[model samples]
Target: MDKTEILNNICYTKLVYDRINKKLKSNYSKTEIETLLFAILKETHEQDFQKIGKNFYVSNVRNNIKITINSNTYRIITVDRLIKTKK
Candidate 1:
């Protein structure tokens, strides 16, 4: 699958997005945040965080998060959802 297809299969939810968004606001680049968010979704769906290090590019040393906003900004919405209709 292509990168976008791989990313699309990630299946991000609002809860996961909030947790990741807070991390992005702290100290993460766009790439790092995306990797972290993917890792989170993978873990939540699989019930473990074992392969995060191997699968994601973000280093474990910097992932220090405590409080989460529980908002819906972390998840990268699909292209279809992002486009706005012109009146």
Candidate 2:
């Protein structure tokens, strides 16, 4: 799905919330996550999208975060912090 469509139709399941809570470093409320996602996604560039299997992964390098979303269902799978490591 396109960025706009994904934004407009973004959804979350009960299990998804559980997964998200365990995934993120900080504990964020459901409302907080939704807001954060909307803001980040609204500013997403074309290069942020990555398709793997049936999922769409949108990442923002500046924020050091990545979000996994189901393409067909528009459900947010999880959020991950992009940890940096020195060479």
lDDT of 1 by residue, 7-68 (tens): 45544544544445553445555566567656644443222222222242212222332212
Residue-wise C-alpha lDDT for candidate 2, range 1-87, written one tens digit per residue: 578888889999878766777877567888887898878877889578888899999988877788998988988988898778789
Model 1 TM-score, 2 decimals? 0.30
Q: List TM-score per model, in order.
A: 0.30, 0.87
Judged by whole-model lDDT over C-alpha atoms, candidate 2 comes out at 0.84
- Poorest 10 consecutive residues of model 1 by lDDT? 65-74
Candidate maximizing lDDT: 2
On the 0 to 100 scale, the lDDT of residue 36 in model 2 is: 86
